[model samples]
Structure formats: structure tokens, C-alpha cells
Target: MSKLKLDLIKNSISYFREAVAYAQRDELDETRWKFAIINVVQAMELAFKEKLRRIHPALIYSSVDERTDTVSLKKALNRLVDPGIGGLVIAEKDPRKIETAVKLRNELTHFECEHEHEHMEAKFADIFSFMIFFYREHLGLETEEFIDYDEHQRIIGLVKARAELRTRARSYIKAENFIDVWICPSCDESTFVAQNGECCFCHHKEAVIECASCGQETLESNVIDTSNYLDWDYDEGRMVLMEDYGMEMTACQGCIETFKSKVEDMRQAQYYEYMEREAMSYSR
Candidate 1:
């Protein structure tokens, strides 16, 4: 790769960082939000061109009327997949994300429309992952380390939250199986639904736990609740929150109530036994 192409890649990364920063700002600033979309697409466009250039410089541009014309982003991406190019293939990358970001940029640039903060956030969330993966795969860089960790996490949270709201409104998805889906506690989206125990979007493992009584798998939160049954270490039987392995036993709601009732009955029996013994002692 020529130093010139490497420089372009560097500039594209800079633009991507700026886009993310602007996107994370207060959405009330319409200009900032708009710039975020614009910068995101531009970053992808430049980064893609750089990758193509690395494979073959002519892949990036065409000579037109003594002036160089950069190839379309879509064309550049299509060419990158060619086996002969053989530089870095974004084989597993989702094309829809880049296409959507480009479409959004064109819409924002040419026309007037309500670019809702929530919509932009969701779109950017997908783009964010796309860019990170591209940089990691092609440039061998950990792009996240270059940004503010806390701020980046906050932006990701907002984006996923917006995506969750959209997923909830999708009645078709909800009709599948009520218990089969859950709003991920980490990403807070149906997008977090994991097949192999891993969230594809955020890469967090799906936190599933088995109901101690029912023996059915459920979201960890659904199974965790306050129980009246006390731990043995406590002097008095007081209600305390318990979960698997946190105490000697943890049970689902129905079982916990049954266990509590049994404990109470046993305590009453023990009291009656003491009273009977005292009466016999007095009689003697």
C-alpha cells in the first residue's frame, strides 16, 4: 500500500471518530446530528476506497477528461470481494448498513425531512460496528482504544435503547413466541437474541438461567427476585434477595412460597413441643 492510501485511511478514521462524537452529543442540535450522518458515510466511503487502493490503485478511480473520478462506494465494495483483488475481503460484512448510511446521507444533504434523533442513533449503531470491524480486519487496528471509553459506551447504550423501542413496536416479531424473546439487559434489544449463547451485535453472552423449581431456561432477571426464605447465616429469618449458588437454595416464586410456609409450620411445631414439655415438667 502506498503511503498516500495509508494517509487516506488515517483521515477516514479521524472523520469516523468525529462522526461518533457528534452523534453522541445532545440531539437537540440538529446540525450536529446531520453532520454525524454525513461524516459517517464519508468515512466509510474513504475507508473503502483506501482498501481498494491498497489492492490496486486503479480500483479506486477512473481517468475522465484528464481529471480523476473516484469510483462509487458501492462499486468499490463490490470490487473488494473479487478473489483476484486479494487484499482484504470484507466477506462477512453486511452491505445493507453501508447502503443505508449512504442513502441517509443523500437524503439529509438534498432534502428536508425530520431526522429523528432516535432513528439516527439506531442507524449509527449499525455503522459503528461496521467501521470497527472494517478497521480491525483490514487495518489491524483496535479503533475503540482511540476514543473515550465511557462516552463511547454511553452512545452505544443510547443506540441500542432506540433499536429496542423499534423492535418492540414490531408486532410481527412479538407474535413468534412470547417467552422466546427478551429485551437484552445489556444492549436492551431483541437484536441481542443469541443462538449460540452469544449476542451478535454487542458480543455479550445471553444471560440465561434455569428456574430452580420449573427447570426452564429464562432470562436471568426474570428468575431473580426477593424471597422470604432466609439464609442460614442470618440470626433471624428475614426476607432477602437470593439467586442460584448465592445461598444454599433458590427457588422460583411458587416454590419459594411453599418453602417459606413449610418453615413456618416447622417452627410452630417446635413451639408446641416446648410448651408440652413445660406442662409435663410442671405436673411432675
Candidate 2:
């Protein structure tokens, strides 16, 4: 598993580099990068095929049909008759990530230049196996370290967090009081929420939930008093602040309480600037 992930990561990075170069020149060759990424996808399928053969040798495959683009690996994956392997391993790689690779592939395959960013999201998606398999299987970073999530989501969250480390802080992520925050679009931040109710800030009028802004603690059925936040009531339209907003930002027990995405907008702009500098440094 580790080796497969590493290979995919290395290949993904290769495509990412090619894509970024195109972006820097303001001339994206989707095909150039796309072809590079499909190699990774093919690698993924091959890994699956090898794994499937281990469980059952009955699985067989034919050369790719001349017409078929080979985007989906259903044929390779389904070849194994044994149900013991588990649900689609494709899901394990995240359709979102696959979509990224596919999108890059398609743009290059069909269009000429269409990638919005100078880079790929999945390329920087974070090698989340750390928070996924390693944390639990190896280091044992259970709910004690954060909220409850499948090892996959946990891995996803950690990968995102570290990838956007410049813009996000684990402390800030804990600040967003969302229920099961697998992803945050605002600052590109992510968190593991246990309890669900209001945003971290009880100021929300529509959804009143109680989420802690500090510490990782949320009960499946944890009940919090709504009237507790008397100080932060809305005064007309402005949020009336009487005490520490950090407290509200800290231990918010609300449901779906996220503030920013991976990184704050300003922070992200700065991040891009720095990246620009670094890219120049690489050439230097």
C-alpha cells in the first residue's frame, strides 16, 4: 500500500511540475500534463490488478479497446471474482483527486489550455496517509487528537491541513465548528468535529449550534444550552461583542462551523506570491 501510494504521488508530482511550468508560461498544454497523469492512473489500475490477482487468479483482462479512452478502470477492478478485497479501491484514491487528474487529462486530450490554476489541487492535496493509516495503524492518533472520522476522511483532513499549513492552523481549523468538516472552502482548512449544532460562533441566527472553539470534544448527542452565549447576540445586524471572541472562536460546539477555506484569502494571495518567488528560485 505504501509503495503504491508513493508511486502514485511521485507520478502525480511529475505531472504537477509539468502543469505548473505551463502555467508559468501562461500556456497550458493539458495534453502534455494529462498524458503524464494518465500514466499514474494506469499505475493505479495496475496496482489494483496485481492486488486482485493475489486474492484470485480468475480475474482476466484484454488489451484496451481502440475506442475506449481507458479513463475508468472498472474492467480491471471487477476482474477479480472474490469479494474479499473490499469496496472499490478507486474510492480510496478519492474521486475528487481522480477528477483532478482526469480533468487535466481531458483538457490536454480535448481542449488546449483550460486549467484555471497554475497547478493541480490534488498535487498539493497532501500525502494524507499520515493522518489516515499511519496515525491510527502506526502512531494511534485516535479521537483523542481530534474528532471521529473514518481513517480515510481523517487522512483527507490532515493532508489538507498540512498542505495549506501557511494559511491554516490546526488551531484555526478547530476554530471552525462544523460537523464532520472533511473540507473547508473558505481558507482551505479542515477539521474533525465530534458534536454538531451551531457554528463556532453562536451568533448565527438561522442555525444555532454549540461547538467548542478549543479542544477536540463533541458528543454524538451532546446537548448545550443555547442561552449560554448572551454576550454575542446580534445587535440589529452587528455582532455585539462583550467578552473574549476567542472563546467563541475557540471552543465552538456548533454544527458545520468553519470560517475560512484552506487559507484565508489574503493569506492565500500571499502564498501565491511566495510560490511565485520560490518557482523563480527553482529556475535560478
Candidate 3:
């Protein structure tokens, strides 16, 4: 292995060990938990780069041709999940959890943010569990190589606690008959109540908007603004509105697909009508 690759593997293991030590501490104050999160995120980034490096040394760079800087965690993840490249299949839900962890790491590192201790603990547990699997299955590390037996058991305990916490939250939401419950993007828990526009488990709130096309509620971030798709006619010096193809200004994912199909049908009909007119003109 090249020196860079060796250093990456060494540093990643060290960071993961430090994170595990912090997580196993009996007296975990705010500082300790913060360190735990920071170290683990660093480990994940380095490990992802190491995998990319193995695939192609240039794969770790932001620009393969320029080679000016290393790739960001998000970019690295996108590359890793690309079927033609890394071929790593991440679980659908896990990607959202990983995104949440990355955001939390950034907030705790560069800015001031407050979070409940339980919520932080849950985030750490999810990352820890996923990292362990990644190290063993993806990196081909033996159990004893990256983690000691006792440390492994402690990590398992943490993961179990997180799972139990989620179960209780789900039961509470169900008992209360919260009809608008959905999986929270923040905590990866199914405790986000659409009616309340907040996650009951983690207290994370997001803007909720009703889809103009389907009339169903969705996250404001997930809605597509369809105004950009409107057709226009440039007549004289001014542009005039031509057609909207019967689409709403905003739509949900399902409605967007339907609108696209309708537009394609309209385009084909217009094409056939033009062909018929041309045929008549030629015949005449």
C-alpha cells in the first residue's frame, strides 16, 4: 500500500477507537459526547476516502483532473453509492440517518446547537452500529482488529438501548392515535406527526405544506415548484404565457410523475396533428 493509504487506515482506526472510548465512559458529559460524535464522523470520512482510494487513487479528489482538494463526505457518499463505480449498497433509511449525523457533526463543530442528551445518544448509537458493520464487512477487518471484545459488547449495549428507546416512542405515538406519524428525517424515528409539524421523539420541527396537485401533506422541502415548467411564447418584444399542461404550481413526487406523463401525451398529440396538416398540404 502507498504511504497515503496506510496513513488513512491508521488514522481512521485511531479516530474510531477514540469515539468508542468516549461512548463507553460511565460519566459522559456534554464535552465527552461531543468528542465522541466528532471523532466518529472523522473516522467515517477517512474510511470512506480510504475505500475510494482503493478503488482509484484519484477517486478521493474533488476533481479527478485538477486534484486540488479532497472530496467532501457528501460527494464521497454519492460516489460510493454509484453502481458503476463503488457499487456499495447502503440501506435506504440509513442514508437519511447518515445525513442527519453529518449535519449534527457540522453544527456541533462549527456552530452552537442544543440537542437533548437522549437524541444525541441515539444518533451516536446509529452511527456506531453502522460503522462497525462497515469496518467488518466493507473494509474486511476482523472483530479484534478494530475493536476489543469488551468494547464490542459495550457498543452492542448502546445500540440495544437506542432500539428500545425507538420502540417506546413508537408505542407512545400509536397509543395517542397520532394519525399523521411519519419517519423523522432528523432522528430516523417514526414519530414526526404531520399535524403538529414536529417530531415527538426528537422535537425536530419542519415546515409542512399541502401538495397543490394531490392535496396530501408533505415536507415543504420535498415539494417541487412546477412554475418553471410553464410554456411561454415570445411574441413581438414580450413573452406571453402559453400553456401549463394542466399542472399545478406545486406538486408532490407522485403528481410530478403524472404531470410529466400528461405533458408527453400532449406533445405526441401535437406532433401527430402537425404531421397530418403537412400531409394535407403536400396532397393539395
Best by TM-score: 3
TM per candidate: 0.54, 0.32, 0.80
lDDT of 3 at 135: 87
What is the overall TM-score of model 3 with all chains considered together?
A: 0.80
Q: Which parts of model 2 have CA positions greater than 4 angstroms off?
A: 1-36, 57-71, 74-96, 117-121, 124-284
Cα RMSD, each candidate? 21.4, 23.7, 3.4
Model 1: pairs clashing at backbone N, Cα or C within 3 Å: none
Candidate 2 lDDT trough over 10 residues, lowest sum: 198-207
Write candidate 1's Cα lDDT for 166-229 as tens digits: 6564454455443455544434445444334543334446566677755766665556443445
Higher TM-score: candidate 1 or 2? Answer: 1
Residue 262 lDDT in model 2?
17
Q: Which should have the higher lDDT, number 2 or number 3?
A: 3
